[model samples]
Target: MNAIIENIDVLLSGFLTTLGLSALAGFTSFFGGLILAGFAISNNPTLRKISMLYVALMQNIPAAAHLFFMIFILPVLGLKAPFFVLAIIGVTIYFSAYYCQAVRSGVNAIGRGQLEASRALGLKNMQTMRLVVLPQGLRNSVPPLINTTIALIKVTAIAGVFGVTELFGTMLQLINVNDSAVIALMLVTGIGYSLITIPAALAAAAVERKVAFNS
Candidate 1:
């Protein structure tokens, strides 16, 4: 208790780092995943093939392996990024593959007639995606998108392994120093993460139901 009170600033700083990483990864994955979905559904066979390969490669690569490559291999090739930035970039690429699949399914669920209608209305392909297809597909994808957001928050723990002082990293250090406070620290971290993830999941569920009814 004394240590925790004394280290409140350290713990709060760590928590903020974790939250920022989560938000960065979440927003990038949403937009990047949408772009990947667009590629996957493109009329160009070459673009679709490339998108398929990208998703497959990202999905098959272990997260640790991906992290190691980004932090290790990329630097050797002269592309050095800060730890937090690298972690966010790597996780966004990894998780966005899954989101691509989810969003692709949502896009497919919308009938071809929607695209045809957009085309008939003089909307270009980009305009159709921006104004017609993606909006409806995203509304349909809200549930899965929410699930992915929760998953991304938990996945930010991976940053700890890279020496990023996120909440988990901070907790690990504190527990190691105090030994007896391990359980308490862990409980706090878990509760903190849950506070972020649970509401996101619930909100997604509500939006999904509402979208379904309006469809």
Candidate 2:
């Protein structure tokens, strides 16, 4: 407690950075996933294949590998970005694949009957998908999407490896500065993370219940 009080500023700074990175990555991945999901379900075989390949590639590789590739390998190829930008890009790409799968499952859950009915109403494929399918599929996907976002938030800790200065990075610094206070500082870090994740989990549960009731 005393240690935490003394280092409150450092903790808060890192917490806010982590929060911002998670939020940015989450939003980018959500939209990017939606785009990929569309392609995955499209009538065009080529687009579907491309989307599937992307998802498979991302899922097979670990996030740390992706970060290392972006931060270390990309520079060799003459592409460079700040660690902050690279972290967001890396996290977004890594998580977007999971999001794509979650959204694809939701889309697949919509029955062929719904598609047939939409076509029977003289709706084109794009129109039907935009107006009818996406609305319903996205609702079904809310819970899993929320879970994915939560997982991504936790994964931002990995960004510390590239010196992104997020929550885990700050904790490591604190540990180095005051080794004896490790346990106390770690407990406080856990509390800080809980403050974000607990609320997100509760909200996800509420959303799931509401979605289930509506269905």
Candidate 3:
């Protein structure tokens, strides 16, 4: 308790860093996923293949490995950036795959009738996807994407291992020096994570209900 009380500023700073990382990664991943979903549904064979390959590679790789490659491997290739920037890139890429799936699944869930209707109106494949599929699919995807976001936020803890001083990193640093407050430090850190995840989770449910009600 004394340790936490004294190090309140440090804990807050770590929590804020985690928030910043999550926000940047989340927004970019959402955009990337949307674009990839478009690619997946495109008429062009090359675009479809590119989408498939990207999602496959990202999905198969472990998130930590993605970050590790950027943090360690990329520097060797002279593609160096700040460790924090590398972490954002790694997280965005890794989670965008999952977001892509969430979107693709939503698009798939659309009734065949919708596609037929678009075609009957002389809408091209790209136009149908842009004006119809994406709008509907994105709405259906909201809840799942938010759930994915919860998972993403939790996984940001891994970034600490690669040099980001997020909440978990703060806990580690404090525990090493304040062995007696280890349990308290851990509890507080867990609470910090819950503060973000719990509200997002609750909001997911509300959004799900709203979407369902509207549909």
Candidate 4:
């Protein structure tokens, strides 16, 4: 307890970094996934194939491998950035694949009747998708999207491997200095993660309820 109190500043800084990384990665992945989902559902065969290939690749690769590639291989190709930036990019891309699938499932859940109704109302394909399909699909996708967001937040700990100094990194540094504090530090770290994920989960549940009621 005293150890945590003494190192509150360090813990807080690390928590803030974790929060920022999760937020940046979460929003970027959400929008990117939407675009990918659009591609997956497009009438154009080439676009569908490209989206399928991307999903296959990202889903098969591990997140740590993605980070390692970003940290090591990208530099060999003359692409370099700060560890924080690289971590963001890695986490975003890693989670976006799952997000794409989640959104795609939601889009698929919409029945043919909805599409036919839109077409009968003189809406073009693009307009029908934009004004009708995507809105409901996104709503239906909230639970899975929230699950992905929670998982991504936890995965931010992997950023420490590349020297990004997020919450897990801070805990590791603290543990090295005071080995006796390991249990306490880990407990605090779990609490910090809970602070973010629990609220997000609650909010998602509320949104899901509202969506169901409206539907």
Candidate 2 lDDT by residue in tens digits, 44-107? 9999999999999997899999889889888899998899899999988888899999998877
Could you give candidate 1's per-residue lDDT for residues 1-215 as a string of tens digits?
76677777888888999999999888998888888888897878998998899899998998777778878788999998798889988898898898898898777777788889999989998899889888888778778878888888898887887878998889888988988777778888888788888898889888887878433
Between prediction 2 and prediction 4, the one with superior lDDT is 4
Candidate 4 global CA lDDT score: 0.88
Count of backbone clashes for each model? Answer: 0, 0, 0, 0
> Which pairs of residues collide in model 4?
none
TM-score of 4: 0.92
Regions of model 2 farther than 4 Å from truth:
213-215
Q: Ten-residue segment with the worst summed lDDT in candidate 2?
A: 206-215
With a 3 Å backbone cut-off (N, CA, C), the pairs that clash in candidate 3 are none
Runs with alpha carbons beyond 4 Å of true place in candidate 3: 121-127, 213-215
The true-structure Cα RMSD of candidate 1 reads 2.7
**Per-residue C-alpha lDDT of model 3 across residues 1-215, encoded as one tens digit per residue:** 99999999999999999999899889888889878888898888999999999999998999989989989999999997988899999998999899998888877777788889999999998899889888888888889999999989988899988889988888898898999999999999999999999999999999988877332
Estimate the TM-score of every prediction: 0.86, 0.92, 0.93, 0.92
- Can you give the lDDT of residue 11 in candidate 2? 92
* Full-model lDDT for every candidate: 0.85, 0.88, 0.90, 0.88
The global Cα lDDT (0 to 1) of model 1 is 0.85
